[model samples]
Target: MSTGRARRALWRWLPPWALDAGLVALAVLDAWINLYDEGTPLIWSCVALGSAALFLRRRFPLTVFLLTLPMTLFMDVAVAPITALYTLAASTRNRPLLAGCVLLNAAASTLAWPLSDGFAGDQTWTLIQFVYTLATATAPVLFGQLVQARHDVALQLVEVEEAREHERALHAQTVLARERAQLAREMHDVVSHQVSLIAVQAGALQVAAKDPDAREAARTIRTLSVNTLDELRHMVTLLRASGGKETELTPQPTLADLQQLIANSGIETTLTGGLPPGISTTAQRTVYRTVQEALTNVRKHAPGARAEVRLWHDAQHFGVTVTNTAPTRPSVALPSARHGLIGLGERAELLDGTLTAEPTPQGGYRTELRAPTRPA
Candidate 1:
């Protein structure tokens, strides 16, 4: 049990308190070995003063060095405590102070060797003795400086890793947002074209039931259905192609496409105002989707009801309002994800714009979106 206790104590890294206690123990042992045989209280008192100085070594290093300087005159090995001065200088990151302390300890130890009692060496042997003493005394402080430099390097590496992780997370979020926007554009293109053809064919079929003068209109409906299916198949092919071919070098729909959208829906459209040229592509795409969704909802949910898409623009602002009237009792139920309005809200916020959707006073839905013409 005693051996195990000794092993555990030796294996542990010493805390500041433990290291200070060790320094005090070493000081006591040195005083007992070096001054007791001389039988003088003055030499013992100097050892006591030097040992007590260890308590303030971390707080005031220069003061500790000064107090230990007088001890070199009495004992040949008395300058050993000045090594702690260099250790403190390294810990505090004071390069000039550490170098000064090293030089002072070397000079004092060399001068005291020849003057002390029982000294019989010439200058050559004395010089050799002083160089060995200086190197041994300075080793602990050099080791301490190396430890401090390694610790600083480790902290810098941790900071760099954290910064890299933050950048990677930001890049992932940006890629996800771009993918979602691309999906929204593709969905708008596919659904809008198919539903437009269906509405046009149904409207033409209704008008041609009683007239012999309507064969051309019937043929137009059939042609539209076939063309819509062909376009849909081509869209599917585009989706499976390598390298996002659907997105690259393809003509994007803009405000000009709104008239085509309305004509294909069999809804008569009137243009009163022009859209601003300075609007960003993202905002224009969002505006196009909002108009497209609103018209599709009118056709599916209010079969005979007409829709009005109004775009109003000024110098610094633009606005869009899509409204439809109440349909008959036999109106069809529209398929909806209910996420359109929320998605519109998010898109408007990205452009620093605003959107509002509410029930119209005439018993239908009205969606209004507004944005700045210039980047804000």
Candidate 2:
């Protein structure tokens, strides 16, 4: 097996033209050795035509084999006829035509060139010679057919591999769709119900509270809970639609919603600057999320802090910066997975952008997002 592979590798390194030239040289040498003695002008001419015809064997195998037959009848030259017959056998699928070609080659080799010389032979000896030549001619044909079968099997294996890969991809997509549907059901049935209760309870507290501070805090809690429910509903809708069915989705937040977001944040925030008019919807959403996450973090970690949201854009880039003052009061620690900034960073990377979050020298915190104006 290793030796056959090495031989095939070597053959592949040789160019097609070089292989054809080598075959032509081998056929010419065979004709020269056979017809060296008993050489006439007519016989030499036949040898020249037969040897040259081998160059076109791959393109016109049957014609080249017929050209070599004339020389075979006049002289004992095997290389040209055998090579031509093998090429024809490998190229054609017609078994009857291949058998006819084998018979013609054998007849040409068995009979003498002149009609009188062939007739003068002993009939039994002539029949024996024909049988031997017929058997010899079939060797190249059988080998050629074997090579052709190996090539066909290699192509079939490649097609089978591609089909398996396609099936695997389809299976993965089906599994992902099923998981998304299950998640949508849980969010709608569990999370939405709890947040709705929180909103209702806060509204009732705001109506009944006698102290102004207590009433104001209850109103803020009610507003935040309602906003959370709206976002949760949108997420559930998207997850359920992951199966590729067209469903109307709630309009996503954009730059126009930035002011309302800051107002309802329950933190003192200032908004300034603006983005260009033609920016894509995806970029707008990225900017909105940046400010939203930054403000939420300030509220959680920097209690009683004032935040400033600045949106800026030039010819090349556009982004938002949310800076917060140091907290006036200590904050209550909240459970967090710390995946918010990581998700924001990934989102920015998808649009060829960057996100930076760090503490300021004066004990404040800053979060900024920068993205290309025209994403590829």
Candidate 3:
């Protein structure tokens, strides 16, 4: 992999033990400097012990502090690096633990001041040495703290970016699902009505060959087939280039399109209720398809039965109900229950709506679609 990617992978897999080992090495170096080169072995040994205790900073911060405090007192003042003390400070994320550790470090460092007379020869020299040593020792600790803070910031940035990516993915999925639903509705509107017209006109031509009506039936079938091809072509164009220039596609049909649907049903269709102006495109398109499917099924299954199409909409919900009068005698060839209603069900579900199909008590089939106005 690339260097940056490999480095990130390595950092993620890095074990805590490795970090402890590195900290221990720093402590050992400081300890050796104190014990081998510093003034007295007793005081230097104490400093070595205290600095060595820093290796336990992550696992047992309290224990590390308790063990180090006494050695810090005996050590020549401020012999240990401030980084070791900073590690102790960093281990305690709690404010109270940090406050207590700072107070203890300051008190211990001050208490050891009497052991160092190198500063007593001159007040200015002593003060300068103390200030320089304190600053130098604390520098590594402050640097480590800053590094830890930056690490925390980087982690938070990663979390936010991950959340944004997840949200974008979810949104894309939702859009795709809705588009599929719209495609199903479009296919249902195109195929069912066109196929039904072909069936009706072809059947009429069989019985009326001697009359001009048979020729008209033939013409109507040709017209419907052409229309079906045109609609299919429009859909194919959209799919080919993902929706070409706007003029190539027709405007999405709405309630206004229902008149042509009812007229083309051939069966007497009585539309009773009004639709709301504020109905959403999803709800409107769903209603249109539900009505079309219901009417197409009525033509296939009930043949000559009268159909009643009702649509009512208010501020909260849009509802559609299509019911047909029962046939005088049940046809042995009622349309098989394979296609239309199932597609409607999926469309309704996408909008958090519902579709129900059942036999009316009066003997005809009834299909109802209920869609809410508000998006969930």
Candidate 4:
């Protein structure tokens, strides 16, 4: 249906022997037509030469064009000579050579007609020969050029489509990578907070237990929880690697502009402390994330519980806490991934900090975060 596919099919279906036989038959038919129309052996011999050249045109196009030129002067209207010129023009685009052949055909036809018998050197007869030569000799070459142009455009279109397909595939791969890295970060947050909480609760149990066996079991639980959290962090680090967010945070929010964060959070929160200047950007970012997660947890687990946010700085570390009073009525279950605190703990660890979350004895929740003021 399409030119490229059709050409491929033609190549597959036609053997060289069959194709050569077809071209030879076409040349003979053209030679016979000239022979019948002229009925002159001299003119017919010249026309036959042009037809015979057809078989070699594919291998020697310019030779075919030159060889067939003298024959155009022999016959008044020859198809074989025109076909030779067409094949040459279509195959090779040597403009000056083709122009010379066309001009020679016109000049020879116009001038040689007078040399024929029954010609009284009439200007009108010469004019008719010129028009016929120009039309018959040049028309086939023009048609060949048109076919060549169309073929070039078709090839160019195919190349452009292939380039676009390659670009699309690369774009898809980039998007998939970004999504995977984002998923790793989210998983890290959930896993770390939950595991850290397990460690903390077990630690408290170990401290309060009186039985030696109970204390030892509690200690084992805490150790396992901490060890598991360590392994999870290592796995997440590998997964998030090469995605720049693995090493440095973007859209970093700091404590200086934290009031806006608190106001927009839709929670009644207070800020009482500020960090002194010269704190590293990384630690400040960790502080910002810790506070945000704390407020988020307060809103989730203690709905309608008036919350208080406190911040303080010592020579070694800066501390943040979000504490809420006991809820009047039990908070309704909200759709939650409950991974916010895990992410928070990891963020604190990045800054040599600790995140502790627990139930207050008064039936409320408290989340505390501490990060080093100086690099460790």
Best by TM-score: 2
Q: Write the per-residue lDDT of candidate 4 for residues 3-79, one digit (tens) a residue.
A: 99999898889976576556656756755665576557766666566667777877887787667665655544455
Give lDDT per model, in order.
Answer: 0.64, 0.83, 0.65, 0.69
What does candidate 3's lDDT look like per residue over 117-185, in tens digits? 543577676566556555554554566567677766775565456545544543553455456546756
Candidate 3 Cα misplacement greater than 4 A, ranges: 1-45, 77-81, 89-92, 113-142, 206-376
Give Cα distance to truth, residue 19, candidate 2, Å: 2.3
- Candidate 2 stretches with Cα past 4 Å from truth are 1-6, 197-222, 240-376
lDDT string for model 2 (1-376, tens) is: 9999999999999987888888889988898888777789888888888888888888999999999998899988889899999999999888999999999999999989895798798989999999999998999999899988888777556545543553454355445656777898899899999999999999999999999999999999999999999999888756643432223465777788989999999899999999888887667877887887788788767868899999999999998999999998555444455556755675577568999999998789999999888842
Show how many residue pairs clash in every candidate, following the order shown. Answer: 0, 0, 0, 3
- Order the numbered candidates by TM-score, best leading: 2, 4, 1, 3
Error of 1 at 356 (Å): 32
Would you give me the overall lDDT of model 1? 0.64
Question: Over the stretch 1-95, how does candidate 1's per-residue lDDT look in tens digits?
Answer: 99999887875756776777677677667657766687367766766776777767777767777666555445654433654665565566777
**Residue 368 local lDDT, model 2:** 93
Q: List the residue pairs that clash in candidate 4.
A: 189-343, 190-339, 193-342
List TM-scores for all candidates, in order: 0.47, 0.57, 0.43, 0.48
Better of 1 and 2 by TM-score: 2
Query: What value of lDDT does candidate 4 attain over all alpha carbons?
Result: 0.69
Clashing pairs in 2: none
